[model samples]
Target: MAVAAAQELDELCYLSAQAMGSLTVSEHFHVIKLLGEGSYGKVMLAVHRKRGSPMALKFFPRESTTLASFLREYNLSLSYCTHPSLTRALGIFFSTPDYYVFAQQAGLYGDLYSVIVSEEGMEEERIQRVMAQLSGAVTHLHSLGFVHRDIKPENIFLCDSSCRWVKLGDFGLARAVGSTVRAVWYESPFCTPEVGPAKEAEKEWERRQEEGTEEEMEDTWITVEPGIDSWALGMLTYCLLTGCFPWEESTHDDRRYRKYEEWFEIERAHDKTDCYAIMEERYRENPPPSQFHGIGSLAMALFKELLNPEPKQRGSPEEILSYLGGPWLLGSEREQRRRAQEAQKEAQKVSETGGLKDELLREGKGER
Candidate 1:
């Protein structure tokens, strides 16, 4: 009974979003429930009073922000994006005396973070499908010469529990390829540092990091790099498979990240078929500071490409497209495991038959 009601609610939300097209500010849409609220604004589940369609409406208070800030995200979601994996605005933007209201697609299953917490860890097959779409979404954005500066799980929406339909959200921070990105937030002693040009302000910050001191540094920024999205993609993939981030931060001072960096050097240079086996042996002796104990071989390979320490060496999101048909594809891990078990059985059977034949020949010779 409850499931049915939830399904009906989801359908209404989808229909409401569709019916909300060409809507005007004067028209009323009643708020059903508050989806979430942050400093930027509050998102509410709303329905058109006349058409009875659903949408998650974001309300930005007029006093808190300017028109430019609202329009930046609203215009990008509505006009620039046409891909299915990327979320879209519902073409509704208006302002009351106190607030600027924007409507967007309502996710039935909420954001990817919610699902990750509930499921603990997603299966590799499911991760493959969801990551494929996200990778495409990132590729599409890159093709437009824009980069999504933030690509965390919270910004990713799951249209369904199986994650067959997912969308990337929160493009407000996206910028042009060569734009200078000042820190998203001010850097403090407690905050992580950035790596800019060798002569840039961040060089001194790097020195501070190397010296194991957290003394305050001057303002710093870096030019947009190619692998920013790729690095986040690798982190997201690792999170989905393990239900935790590989490391809390990428700073060299971070112990967990340092361990991963050490292993990554070995994993990157050695291309032998027995490379994974070698890693397994070393892992047993001294495990890295990550929860990625059971990751499959091909998945690990993709992670290496995406998370290369040198940003320029990291592969693009589109590189994941080819992996869809390879071992990184859905069910590939289980399929490989099954094949290995089958081969072991076949070899055992052959050995047993050889022993039986030899025993029979010996008995016959003894009788003669």
Candidate 2:
């Protein structure tokens, strides 16, 4: 939770060509240092000289036909930027045919992945802060009709003096309702395999007919829902608490059908002595967070609700906000009285104005 010295921070800065060369954005910004790289492109710590604040500039190479998608993602991120736990997408600029630029407020402390790996474990209070922040951010995103799709530790960052602020980043895989694109590895457990060409569909149908029985067929396929995010979140919470993954390498040699079976056996056999054991049991049969030691009870409760295997059983963002004590839903319990007053005020304002603005200023409209 302590701030690293300037020299120490400087040592952590990585340099690469992606961070060195000038990015082709509509407007110019000083590229300071490379923050990190990903499958799509590199993110750099940049400074808008005129604005006088550090920003993260993500550059996407134009060869992959992902320009339009990346632009849409960036624009979507901007709409949810006001939440304390969410990163703010300032603006996006595309200057050339081969590059796309995404600008965001820079976090002084790095990502949760590096932080957890470096510190080994975070304090309970810090962990609770992070969960509360993430819960708020996710709730806000859901309210705006978006799902992060990818919710790994690497995509969460910390800012401010005590590294208390948590921001969800990397919107490239985020999806709105009706979006067909899916994020690999972060795929929902319920996701069905993508149907390919006509021949492929025919083959799949034949395979299904061969399998027979609804139960047997369901076992052979997967479906995805918001619950998948919950599962990933549970994995993350376990990593934060135990400093390891629940499904560590098993001794079995089965690489295909039998691998998961072998791993599940191992998971079942592990003695409930350490944090890992608790995690394993929770993965198998979720227990309330209050049962866990050294972790915030509220956070664990939220985790249980989020990671419920049954998508229908999983908690909604509003429910999560309540569990985290979010301010949006707090106040007096006289619901209908407050609602009536608010409705009257809205009616008065509408009568005064004739109607709502015909053209609402949609935020985050441009591409990065």
Clashes of each: 2, 5
Where does candidate 2 have its weakest 10-residue lDDT segment?
1-10
Give the per-residue lDDT of model 1 (tens digit) for 199-302.
34566778888999978777657767657888888888878876777666676656777788888776665553445557446556655445455665566667
Question: How far in Å is the alpha carbon of 7 misplaced in model 2?
Answer: 47
lDDT of 2 by residue, 60-150 (tens): 8878636456656566666555787788778545435676676887776788888675324555446656776777777776656566767
True-vs-predicted CA distance for residue 165, candidate 2, Å: 0.7
RMSD of each: 10.1, 20.9
Which candidate has the top score in TM-score? 1
| lDDT of candidates 1 onward, in order | 0.72, 0.55
* Model 1 global lDDT (CA atoms, 0 to 1): 0.72
Q: Candidate 2, residue 359: CA error in Å?
A: 80
Q: Which is the leading candidate under lDDT?
A: 1
> Residue 149 deviation, candidate 2, in Å?
0.7
